[model samples]
Structures are given as structure tokens and as C-alpha cells.
Target: MRYLVAALLLASLPVFAQTVAKPMNDPKTDTFLRQFAETRRFMSGRPTKPRITPDEKTVLFLRAQPTSATQTLFAFDVATGETKELLTPEILLRGAEETLTVEEQARRERMRVSAKGFTGYDLSDDGQRILVSLSGKLYVFERATGKVLELKTGPGVIDPHFSPDGKQVAYVRGHDVYRLELATNTEKRVTQGGTEAKTHGLAEFVAQEEMRRYSGFWWSPEAKHLAYTESDTTGVEKLTIVDVMRPERGGNTFPYPRPGKANAVVRLGIIPIAGGKTVWVDWDAKKYPYVATVTWKKGGPLTVLVQNRTQTEQQLLSVDAATGKTRLLLTEKDDAWLNLDQDFPRWLEDGSGFLWYTERNGGPEVELRKPDGSLAQSWVKPAAGFFGLARYVDADRTLYFYGDPNPTQSYLWRVRDGGAPEKLSTGTQGPAHEQFAHVAKSGGLSVATTQTATTMPRFVVLRSDGTRVGELPSVAVEPPFAPNAQFFQVGKEGFHASVLRPRNAKPGVKLPVVIKVYAGPTTTVVRHSMAENLLNQWMADKGFLVVKFDGRGTPLRTAAWERTVKYDFATATLDDQIAALKALAEKVPEVDLARVGIEGWSFGGYMAALAVLKRPDFFKAAVSGAPVVDWLDYDTHYTERYLGLPQEHPEAYEKSSLLTYAKDESKPMRPLLLIHGTADDNVYFFHTLKLSDALFRAGKPHDLLPLSGLTHMVPDPLVTQRQYEWVLGYFQKHL
Candidate 1:
């Protein structure tokens, strides 16, 4: 398989046009663009939402269709080694267009899901019934009879989940949470007093965008209770996102928490499954306002993790399910700020203790705490970097997790309750470069996706004992292009970077450079995964040397390394990019730094614009997409967490904002292209427009391309393809 992958990579290289200069829209480039946009994505066959049954006999996953951006349900029988399609969008949609409600569309945007037809689904505890929401409607699929039933649950339903016992389906409609009985066909509202400004059982913008918390409610193991969040956004400022393209349709006005602004008032409560008095959890809402996480076990008390506004201190509280009384179990603190860890504060099977993760040992470590909040045992393996815990298979008395000692490689490992951790993934297959696994809780089964530096994603099903069973089929067609990146570390910081020269460039020829970057907090562009650098390869194919790196402030590093930007957001990220470029330029003499260009989206977009505006000597051109020009305009939770309140640190605000440099005469003029979606609610079209206004006032020459009706995500394939062409043409003109 490794040799086959290498053969495919060599075959995909662009055929050089030796005789004449080919048009930019040549067949090769078109094919690359198509693969980059449509061919390799939705319907091209990638498995999502993998579910392993309790019995471990079946593995269910959603597979995309080849003809459309719709997903179909597939089931893999482990015993028989057979993969079969269970349901497709054609049968579920019945040829009807998937019409998403406004609320549902926003939710999908938050979750970054652009595909249609059953984007998400929930499986019952018994794995007998599946609850699916399609086009704002609810449907249930039964495994025993292979039947589908649509429940008339009204309009605007979102975030549906089945009860632990599979007796009822609970979902959020309008602004409140509702429960529907399966047998009686009866519906009941669990909590009341939900309005446009106050919502129940739905994640707020900060929780979804910053904290990575998607759902606002969790069902108890007994199916008799539910713990839901009630968020009141009356304090946060409201912003209207207008659609200038469609004058007939008005805009959507919702709470937008800007820097130094008020955040939503959130409260947690427990209610009976059949509708009863709501028991609100009591905690110091003033001090610890942010509910970072919530977890409920079958026999344990409800657990909540809350943090203060500064995020320096976080407390784990256990709430009484009946009385709503809360007891502070433990408090974790850091001098800078506490980072949210995934799958932390997990409950043990016996319910006598729980598992928690910490970095107090100068590295990542796992701690077992008794029910009384006293620490029982703590374990930290050498070089076990801080990836999240995957699962704790009680049957095997082992816990599985993901971690990487090397920055570019990751793997799966299992450790006994009080024993040394052992690597579970195989290294012989492909070096185990980048791996992810989902270990089933009940059954001794696990599904994993393992990819190497040169290999495409390979999905395999394995037993808890590391026995390989079968592989999930990928319908995706290999792209007619391949990446050839040289990975290395540079500078005293040992910054990770990948340098890709133009594939078609002549030997010893000088090439213009393009630094593709997403040098943002908690993100790294340089990695060993094949999917991580495809776009970088395409840019290199277009005749520019492409560079990518993870500088200061990116995660997967030490807490000190990531906290470099806690008080200063712009310096480390930008300085490191420049340093990496200079270091690589010294090593690779073919790099023509005189004609360098930079491009990025969101935070990277901010970096791109910042590079040309603040350091025009290094970057000659920039393409900024939906850039957050001003830190003050960003959300309170994210911006404040890094730069503090704008009101308190006015100097830092002025220095970090790009608007401050818009008219600086000290910096020389550079060609820049500003692209933004007018319907972008996260960064807001106002950001780009305001920056453009500043540039116009300063008489700075620049180009602006505004996309209408597109949100933060550019879901249209045509637009995505055209975007690459535009950027390429702009670079050609400037460089």
C-alpha cells in the first residue's frame, strides 16, 4: 500500500508545457482546482460519525455520495466482514430539496458542516434506532425493520438526541428544549421562559466558537433526567447581519460579545424527562461565569467546570441532581490562563472516582480523584505530549488516548489503570505519522484513521487487543496532484516548518515565494498528515515556493510556548513567520525573497495583512480573507483571553489592531487584495469594510472582492475554485 501510494503520487505530477506558455486555466490547473474543491470532498467518500455498537459486531458510519454533497448511512458487519449501505439521502429526502431553517443554518455554520442530507445523527443506547434531522425535519430509522418514520415535530428543530433508554427523543425547537415520547406520540416542553434573547439547550457563540463546546445539554444515564443550559444574551450587544444582495430579505440581529463587552448570562439546571420543576444549579455566577464543560455519569453526580472571566482559575463542581446544590471539588489555576482540555474530568466506571488531566507536572499528566475530591493517583509517561484522552474501556481495565512525542507524529496508546502506557497502533504499516482512534466503551472494539507522511487516510477497525479486523472503503478519487514538502526544524525555538519548491521549476532556478500560514492560537499548519498540506502543494505547483510553520502561540507545545501571546497577540506569530522565512531562505538559495507574497484566512488573514502593512520589506503582496483588522471588534471571550480587556490595555489594543497601521507613512506601499464574505457573522463584514475605509482614507491602493450570501465558510465549490485563480492571478500581477 505504501508503494502504491508513492506510485500514485508520482503519476499525479503536472505534465509540463514545454513548447508554449499555457493559460492559467489549463486542464491540469482545472483538475487541481476541481479536486481541491469538489471532487475530493463531499460525496467523494469519507466516513464521518463512526459508531461502534455495544456488542461490537457492527460499525456504522456516514459516507458521502459521489454525485452530490449528501451523506448516506453505511454499516460494516465486523463478524461477516461486509460493508453495506443502510440508507441514502435519496430515500430519506424523497427528491425534496434540503431546506435548512435560519437557526439550523447558523448551527451548521458554527459546527463547520457544509454538506447536505443528514449532516448529524444520534444512535440510541441499544443501537436499535437512529435519530436523524434532515432539512429541518426529524426522522427515525429502525435497524430491525429497516424502516424510516418522520415525526411531525413542527419547524425549526435542532440538536436532536435520543434518551438513554430510547423511549423519547429530545430536541430544541424555537428557543426551548422539547421531548417527544416514541410510543405515545406525545410532546412536552421541559423548561419554559425561552425567548429570542434567552435560549435553552443551545450553545452560545463563545462556547461554540472559542471553547469548542457544541451542545448545551446532556441526558442522564437513567433517562429520567436532563441537564440543560439556559443562556440569556440580553447583556451582550446586538449586531444585525444584513444581506445587501437580497434587499427583500431583512437581516438577522443577534447578540455579539465584543472585546470588553458583556457576555451572555448562562445558567445550568436539571429537569425531569416528563416535565417537572426545574432545579437550577447554585454557583457563584459573578466570579465563575463561563461554564467550560459539563459531564454526567450513570450513577455519579452532575459535574460542571466553570472559569472566571480572566480564565486563570477554573473550578470543578459537583451538582446534586435533585437539590441543585453544588460542591467545589477542585480548582485548577495558572499564571497565564487555563486551556480547555478535551474529555477531561471523565467519570470512572465504578463511579467511586474520576479521571482528570493536568499540566502541573511541567508536562501533561492524568490524575485519578476519588468521589470526595481527593487525589488517588497521578500518572505521566515520559514524552507523552498533551493530546486528549480517547476512551477508558472498563472491560479491559485500560484507558486509550492520543499523544505524540514528536511534533509531527501522533499515535494511539493504551495504559492500565496503574501501569505503564504501551503503544497500540502499528508502526510497520506506514510509520503511524498521524493517527486518531475511537475506542468503544462497552465492546472491545476500536475504529481508527491512520495516515503517514506519504499515505492517504486509511480507516481501520481493530479489537481492543490490537487485532486488525477490516478497513472502511473510501470512494474518494486520488487527486491528479501530489505534495512534495521538505519538513525540518529551524531557529533556536526549533520551529516546525515545511518548505515546498515549485514542482515544475528548473534546476537551480530562482522562484518567487508564497508563505501559506494559519499562525493562529491553538493551530499549526505544518504537519505530517497528507491532507494538511494539499493546498500548499497546489500553490507550489503554480511556480511559487510555499512555506508553512508553527511559531509561538500555537498549541501542542508547552504551556509557556503557547502563552507567549497571552498579553501580546501580534508580535510572536508575525515575528516567527518572518524568522522562519529568513531561516529557510538561507538554507534554500532558490528562494527569491524579493518577490515574496503571503495569504491566509481568519487569523491567518490578519497575519497576511499585518505582514505587508507592518513588514513590507519582507512581503511584497498579501491576500487577506475575512481578516479581523481590529482586536476590539472580535468576541470578548477570545480576544480578552489573549489581550485582556481593551479598556484596560488601550496601548496593546492599538498595537494589535491593523487599523492602526492602515495609514502609517513609515511603511512603504504594497499591493494587497482583500476578500471577504458579506454575510460573515463571525468576523463580520464590518471588519473588512472598516479596514477598506481606512485604506481609502490613507490613499492606499488595494483590491476588494466581496462575496454575497456566504458566511464565514465558503461552501460553494465554484467560488472556492475561482478564489484560488484570483489569488494566483493577483500574485502573478504583483510578483
Candidate 2:
């Protein structure tokens, strides 16, 4: 009788111990656990903007530098590793007063002056004068005297360049090319008859954004002539985006062409500096698409790269500058569209031939071709890596380039101009990032390095043989967070998973999970770099597991992975995400799948809404802000890329729409909260209005928060705080 009673007491004691396990927010075991509101308030500090100096050695970035409401730029020296004040508050105020008129001055006093520094500046070949643009006006400053000279005052002055002799400066003004002679103080119009409707010597919207060619003019080596492109937008389609600033007043429209649409026509022309007629380069515009990049050969014919609208076929053509007779120097084609290398092909000093990059055999390979049309014996074959262009081919026939032979990391590579390539810098083992700087006359390379998962970019100078000459000063990041937070990867079935355990996480404690997603076609949410991303860190600090992964349609990857959702964008990508979630649930036992929630912005918001509507079994709640519920609601350029034409593919568009899938409201789906800005031009406020109406008609429960007077990219502090509050509150309630 005594043994039986002891055995029963021991069994009952084990059961009682399981029931008394500490709660997630216990005072003893979970002393660091802060309330969601408190955590959010702690994280909602002032915003920080990054600034890089012209020299690339010092990073004059802002972190809480509050001399004023807007950011203030500081100066840092890499050599001494010291920082000093460069742009004083008095200087900024004076500059503001000089630029603004009397009526504008009163209004500007009330408005915060944001820091708008130099985008790109040029030092004169003699290094005596510096040319910089401040708010579209070109200002020349003497290096030693610090005196400012207004060279050419205009609204659209861009891409200003100085002649080799530093006697003349050329810049783009009002869609036309202009040359300023410093000696005579006279400005001459090189190209004429530019209008708002038609451009004469400047690139159009598509050429600038897609091809990455900002300047349309280039000066010859002798400085005696200028080569430029004139883009004609007479036949291109125009897109009008409504301005939500003033609801009573309608918006303005601009010309924008999408894929397979009629793009602006481009023509190359050369003008002599001595004042002559603009001679059009002879090329069959109908048969061969216009040139994207134009370069003059040293004492030889001019070279131009031409590609079709589809971008599958490419040709490097050499044209006679005197007569405009063109002959194809090299031709390459691919099954998919080829990326046009617009980095101004460098001409060897000898003028025998030039080097070109081709991905014809899968990856970028170097090809040395002669002046006529034959390939030189010296050529770099394709390797199992990516190759990028670096400036200057030295006298020893050594070509410099940079790449990551391994997809996981990047490094610089130097190839003997005629032979095989050799790795110059061995990057950090995991997720290394590198960027090459502007080549110096001394024949050395300036390189920037950042370890894996670091946001702060550091610079270093290296000799031609890959030896480090000097190290630049490091940029500062706030709060001193851990170097390694978390990284995610999609499984074999394409599901999302990330490891976000705290630095001192307990051995066996289940954590709530939050999925931060931006499942869009144009941009990917996941990348191996140091970024102070708001959502990822906010939830991670609140003891929630975070996960982010690319669906099928994100850009900057292989075409096969990107084009998988040709006509079916949402469905295919969503399946991969759902698969990822299921795999993560099986692997991570500490993940509380029952408390899973999803949140996103813009296109990501659309995915969050679909996750609850389509796969309610996986997520408990979702928060979507500025989502595009329907394809037809967006602009023509972005939507037409994946779905072809709306008239032809109405069914595909309908299937992809979230409104069509909102029929089954009786299921045990997660709660949804939709947020939008009334004045969003990119996604438009109508998206939420239409979506809300559909949800109401289907008898679905949703929360709608409308932000007034906010644009597509919301920068308002109050609006951002409210947005974060609404999202965090929704997840806490449901999850």
C-alpha cells in the first residue's frame, strides 16, 4: 500500500511541473521582455540619411546630426581618420537666401531645408578648378581660392564635363548641348531646337532609366568635336499620373513607354566645335536599332554599339566620322535579352582596336577586336564567373575587371590583355561585397570593401598588383547592433525560412513568427548586405522570428527564375512562398506557427492580402499598406511587362486580381488591415477604395486607414509612426 501511493505521487508531480512552466513574459525568466508599444517607441527614433563625398575617401554621412530639421553634411578625411565640419549652418542659410526669391523666402523659412549635395562632380584635368552642380545649376570653384563662379545658370544643367586642356566646359542645358569657354566667358549652343516635347541632344526616360545612360554627349580626345544622340519622342505613348497633392486639382501626365511599346527614336550626330551643321551618323535606322553608346577612336573611326528594341541582338559598329559609313566590327546574339554595356568602351592609345564585353557564351568574356572586322589572337574566354569593367588597360596589355566568380561573394580580377585572367583580391569568405573606384592617372585602383552583412561601406586603394595602398575611414552606424542578425533561404520546393534567434536565446523556448515580405516583380526583399531595415529589426527585437525570401518574379537574377510567372504572376510565386512556410514549420520546432503573421508595403502588401485570402490555413493575420489590388489600376509601363496587353489577356489579369479570389469568406482565414495614402501617385488611392468596396460586398472584415496628403514614397514622420503603430497593433491583436 505504501509503494503504490509513492508511485502515484511521483507521476502526478511530473504533470504539475509541466503546467507551471514560465510564461513568455515572466518577470524572473524574461526580464528583458518589453511591451510591444514600449519596444516600438524605443525603435521609432529619428531618421538617418547616407551621404558620400566626391572623393569617395571620406563619407560625410548623417546619423542624428541635427543642427536643423533636415540633414547636415560633414566632412571626413581618410588619411588622418578625422572628421570636421565642411558645410556650416551659416553657409547653408546664405545659399538658401540667395536661391529663393522674396515670396519664396517667406515660404522656405517655414519649410525645412533638406540637404541636397553634389551627385557627381568633376575636377579639371589640371586639378586647379572643380565643377559641381547644386540644384541643376553648374558652379565652378577655384580649388585654392575657394571662389565660386556661375558658369551657366539653367534649370537642367547636367553631366558637365571639362575639356582636356581645361580651357572649355560643356554641359547639357534644357535638352540641348552647350559649351562654355572659360577664357572668353561665352556660352555657345552646340545643338539647337530642343523643346519639352522633343529632345535634341539629351537622353529620354527609358534610355536614362533602363540603359543607365544619363549624358547623351561625349567630347573627342582632341576637344575639337562633340558626339551626341538626339531622341525623338513624337511617336511614343504618354502616361498621365494624377497628382494626389490637391484632391480638387487634377494631375499631370508624362510620356512613358513599356516593353513592346513604341519607344522614342534615337539618332547619333557629330558637331564640330568650330560651328558646323550637325551631321547624322549613317546607319539603317529601320533595319538596325539606334546606337546606345558612342565613342571616338584615337586617330581612327568612331565606334558605336547598336541593339534592337528587344535587346536580343547586338553589334559593335565602326563608322567613318568624315562620311558616316558604318561597318560591323563585332556581332553577338542571345536567346534572352542582352544587357547593353554602356560604360563607354575605352580605346587603346595605339588606336589599333578596342576591347568589348560579351555574354554570348553564358558569362561576360573579354574580346579584343581590330579596327577592321576581325578578332585579334588575344582574347579572354568565358570563365565560371561574372566580369565587370574597370578603367585603364596598361601598356603591358593587362586588362582590369572585377567580379564574384562565386555567386556568394565578389572580388577584383586582372587578366593579361591577351591571356588568361588571375584573381587579384580574395574577398571575405562569406557574402563579401566590393566596388572599384575611379581610375587614377598613376595606374592604381581604388576599391571599397564591406564584410558580409555589413551596411557601412569602407574604401581602400590598391596597386595594380592587388596590394593595399591605403584604407579609407569607416562610416558609423547607430545602436551598435550585432554583426550577424539573420539570413533566409528558400528550400528545394521554394519555401521561405530564416534564423533570427537572439544572441542569448534560451535553449528551448518557442518564439512567435513574423514574415516580412515585399513580393514584387521589380524588386527583391532579400539581399546579403547591411541595411537598417525597419520591419526586420523591429519584430526581431520583440522576440519574434522573422523570415524573408524571393518569390519567382524578383529582378537581378537569371531570366529563367525571373520569367517563371510570365502570364501567371501571383499564383506561381505564392505557391513557392507557401511551400517555404510549410518547410520552415517542419524544421523549426521553436517557431509558433499558430501565431504566424505577414506584413508588407506596396506590391508586398498585395501579397500579404493574397496570403490570407488564398492560403488562410498558414497565416493568422496580415497587414497590407499601399497594395495594388488590381493590375489595371497601375500604370501601363509596369503592368504590361508581365501580363502583356490588358485587352488581349483579360482573363490572366482577372485571375491575378485579389478581388476575384475574395469569394470564400466563410473560411477560418486571418484578419486583414489595409492602409493607403490618399495622394499616392504610384499605386494610387483608388486601389484601396476599390478593394474596400469588394471586401464589403463579400462580407469580409477589414480595417482601413487612409493617410491624407501623402505621396507614393511617404517621408512624413507622423505618417510613418502611425503606419508602424497600426501594423504592430494588428499583429499583436490577431497573432
Candidate 3:
């Protein structure tokens, strides 16, 4: 009954609003957008993929080249504190332009990697040779000689990993897995019978996008065998993406399963690197169709985590290396659905036991379990927090972890065997907000990154005694304007929210408000990192107070907080946004609740559309980008997990659909602007078009703008700059 009657009734409805606004010339806005091009990235100087050598003599990381959006590999000498460039993308490619395959492009999209050159690499066990892929060709760089050798491998090769002994490399090509002998320069096909409809050693669409399981293969400890996934996607539905601007290029069709549709059938198998018979792991595929995680560590049995169709039940099974026989080691069942942790089910150095994280006590806690699946000890006591273990220091009998006691704030801590956990990061400088620390098991050396809403991320090396060794140089050009975000916990639920005021606003003046949100399941909006809110800060500077909060449905908190949206996705997510807004507005005098707006993309887009259509009194104007109008059009794993099967729980789908509200002629018609890319395959472009069709049938008015070739992600800097300007003008004109 919330949106039964809108503020702009049928009689008061105005003419269709303009879809495009004139570009405004603002110095501050121009400066902010220019940073994206000048820095080559929003937050430049960020050291990525920092790995300590086994000898602890050097640390290897990737840094952006100042002139171009490409990464160069650099090695930092631990003893001298001097950094030296090992390989530059220009020298490695020999000035040849890099060409990516379709598979590579999709992987980059899922990872949100817009930069180029040496995105990832793997070092050998002895740290002698580093294996990397450039433009679908394999390359090996010798650390001692500082020489790069590009092998004559064919195109479309991806995810090449060096064997444990560093004698061979395993990679995927044309849906099949292959092994290359480094000594003789001989190549052997490890697994055969792969087609376009089915693939081996490659993750399915849902696994990479939703489940966060990027790699589809696991290597055994002795380097003699490999475990990989074979996904048969023939059963899944197909969605076509067309480049309407070029009619000659018809469309590309791919298997994209919708809600209540068949998902790709996945099977796990064990293969020998020496070319032998394939051993398929046995499991109840009908009951558990989703493979969530796989782990194969030295001296331990191969383990896999599988979940049911509804994701309500998960089984952790141990696979025999030789026979591929599976035995259920542990099983977890929840009334709603199981949530996956980033780091869990990790084996100890001795391989006698492992660490398992569970929410049986209402929040996530670490528990040590023996290989026989018996409880050993409570490694980390039950607390209202989420924990992700970074490394286990077997010598000191301690495990280093990063967790958040409060959902919005994060810190690093160490938990010893039979001892209470001790906090290591105090955030003394400002707020430990989003701090991450990684410890090296060999040398007792660690690295930590600290950042806040007003602070740029900085990396520092630390000794075992928590003494700072030296800070690594960051090439990031910090923004000229100081961020004005104030963190607060509001309402009876203690919802975490950040409010950003206009940089030049006076203390007594109130400004119009905008709520930018992605109130989807398992996504958080309230993080301590400054980079997470740069766009919001820029929006705040445009004479609007920006507010973002993590509602009941999002993750990073207790299990109970997330369970509020079970079978009720629309109600809890929308209600919490409204409650947090009203509570924060009452507490802060700068928030003008009378003139409010909402904007978001993807899940946030859905929430934006839902806000105006359902609660017009609160959200006067909205801009929805690639919104999911109907639950029936969404994918299987994500939608069915939260709302249940469409057939079994039809009411849940009806309650979550925006089409129902659009067809209701009595409901108010607010100023809604819909934006989508015609080539958005993840959330298809038809979602907005279908909703527009419904509005037209109801004789309602709205605005629609479609980008020509953009996908679900806005990778082009110009496109992102224009998008912000368009949104700013729309809000200014409407609010």
C-alpha cells in the first residue's frame, strides 16, 4: 500500500521529459573527469598482485605506466628498499598491438580490468621463472637473466599456469586443456572432445560473474595430475547481443540461462599431465548442480564445494586423486540459502586439519576441523563480524586475517592457537576503514594497505614485530578537492551510511539529496575506501548531498541481517532505504528530504526504478540504468536463490516485478529516466524496453536512452564522463 497513490496523479502528469541534456561546462567537474585520463586510472600508483619471494629477498608487483593504461612488472628489493622495472609492456610486446580473443575480453569484463598489459602472472615454486600471457601468447621471463622469451603458441590461449616443478605449463585453448613441455618445446593435448557448446577448464558464466569462482581448474601438489571442470552449456538458454549500429554484423549468441531455466551442467574430473584416462568425480548432479569452490593443496585430498539448485544446501566433498571417488566431508544447510566466503576450507601446513567458517552462531566464525571432519577447536571465537584469513604462520602458531567487527569498518588481526585474537591495525592515522594486511609464511614479513573516505590508499611494509620497514612509492595523483563524507550509523537497526556534503556549501544551507545505491544481495555500499565513493563525491560537489548505505539485504554483516530479504527481495531492500534516509535526514540538517532523487545501475538500477514507482513521495526523480524490470528475465542462480522458483513461489516473482506497478494506471507518474546499452548481455537491454512497453500500454510517459555499443560495464572514460554529466543535469532540472 505504500505507492497506492503517487504525488503526480494522472490529471497532473506533464509532457514527456527530455531524454538528453545540454553539456554543462563546470571547472570542478572537468577536473574530476580529466583525472581519469591523466592518471590512466582513478586511483593510480596502486601496487597490484604483491607477492613475496620464497627467500623474502624481493617483492613483485604490477604498477601502471604513467603515459599509457598498461601495467609494467616491477621488483622491489627488500634489503635495499630500491625498486627496479623488470619487464615493460612495450618491450614485451615489441611495439605490436595486443589483440584479445572473445574469451579474454569476457574474463576482463568480469574482473572489471580496463587497463592493458601483464594483468596477471604466476611464479614458479623456486621463483626462477615467471609465466605470463600477452595477447593470447605465452611468455616466460627468467628472473636471473632478466630475459623474456615468447613461445610460438597459437592464439586464444588463456590462463597458463606453471607446474609445481616448473618444467611444464598447462593452459586452455579452443575449449580444451593442453600442456606444453618447456624442455623439448613439445605440446600435448591433455583433454579432448571440446566444442563451442561445451568447454573444459573454463568457468561458466554464473560461476565467474555471480559465484566469484574465476578459475575452473586446480593443479595437484606433485604436478602429476590436474583437476578441471567440464561445463555442458547446451541445455542453457541463449541470448543474442546485436550491434545495431552495424547491421551487417548480425549478432552473437551465447548461452545465458534465465530464471527457472536450465543452467549449464557442470562435472568435475581428474586428468593426468602425462596424458592418461580421465577420472570423473561422482556426485548427485540433480540435487547439487552448482560447484562453488575447489581446493587442491599439497599433502591433502582434493576438495570441492557443491550446492543445490536453490542454494539452500551445500556439500563439501573429498575426491580421491586416483579414482575420483567423492565422500562428503561436511554439509551445510540454511533455511534460506548458503552464502560463500572468500577464504575458507583452507588446509593447515601440516595437512592434518583445516579451517572452516560457518554462521551457525548467527555470525561468521572460524572453526578448526580435523581431516576426519571432527571439530578440533574454535580458532576464532564467535563474534558479530566476517573474517577472511590471509595466511597461516605455522612457526608462530598464529593465523593472520582481515575482518570487520562493524560492517562498515575493517581491520587486520592475528589469532593464535588456543589464544584470543589480537587486533594489529589500529587505524591510528585516520580510520582503519578498509585496511588489508598479508603476511609471508617464510620470512615473517607483511604488507598492509590503509585508506579512508578522505585518504588515498597507501601501502607499507612491516616486520613481524609490527615495525614499518618502508612505504612503497605510489604514483597516484591525489585529487585536488578534499572529500566531505561523514560516516554515521542511523535508525534502530544501526544502518551504516555515509553522507557527502557539497564542498562549498555553507553550514546553515540545506541542499537537495540524492541516494546512490546498489541494494542488491551480497553487495555493500558502505566501505571505508575512498576510491569506492569518488563518483559520489563528484556528484556531491554539484550542489547535491549524496547519501549511500548498506541496507538489510546486502552482505558483509551477520547472517540474520541478510536473511531479512528471504522470499521478500523488494520489500526489505526498499523499506530499509526509506528508513535510513528519513533517519539520517532527521539527524543531519543538511539533507533536504523534500527534494530527493535516486540513481543506480544494474541492481541499483532496479532499486532506483522500484523506489519511484513504489514510493513516489520519497523519491521524486530516478535514473535507472539497465534495470531488471521482470524477475522472469533474470538469471537462474541469483534470482531463484533469493525469491525461490518462479513456479513454486509465483507471488514472490509478482511482488518483485516492476511491470505490475507500471500497469497500474492509478499510481503516480514521477519523472523517470531509463538508460541502457543495447549490447548489455548480462542484464539484457530488453528489460528496460519491456518496461517502457508496459508504460506505453498504460498511457504513461518516460524517457529512454540507449547507448550504441556499451556493455554492462562503462569502460570508456568519455562514456563515463558524459554519463555523469547527463545524470547531473537531469537531477538539476527535475529536483
What TM-score would each prediction reach against the true structure? 0.94, 0.76, 0.95
lDDT of each: 0.80, 0.60, 0.80
Instruction: Decide which is better by lDDT, 1 or 2.
Output: 1
Misplaced by over 4 Å in model 1 are 1-23, 27-29, 40-43, 380-382, 426-435
Supply the TM-score for candidate 3: 0.95
Which stretches of candidate 3 lie above 4 Å from their native place?
A: 1-17, 23-29, 37-41, 426-428
* Model 3 alpha-carbon miss at residue 701, Å: 2.0
lDDT at position 635, candidate 2:
48
Over 626-684, each residue of candidate 1 has an lDDT whose tens digit, in order, gives: 99999989998788888887877788888889998887977786888877887888999
- Per-prediction RMSD in angstroms? 7.1, 11.5, 4.5
Candidate 1: count of backbone clashes, pairs at least 3 residues apart or interchain: 1
Q: Give lDDT tens digits, candidate 2, residues 349-433.
A: 7877667766555455667767675767545565535445765554666666665544334566666756666766533455655
For model 1, state the Cα shift of residue 168 in Å: 1.5
Residue 602 lDDT, candidate 1, scale 0-100: 95
Estimate, for each residue in 21-101, the C-alpha lDDT of model 3 and write its tens digit: 554648464777656545644565677777777777778888885435678788888889999889877887788999898
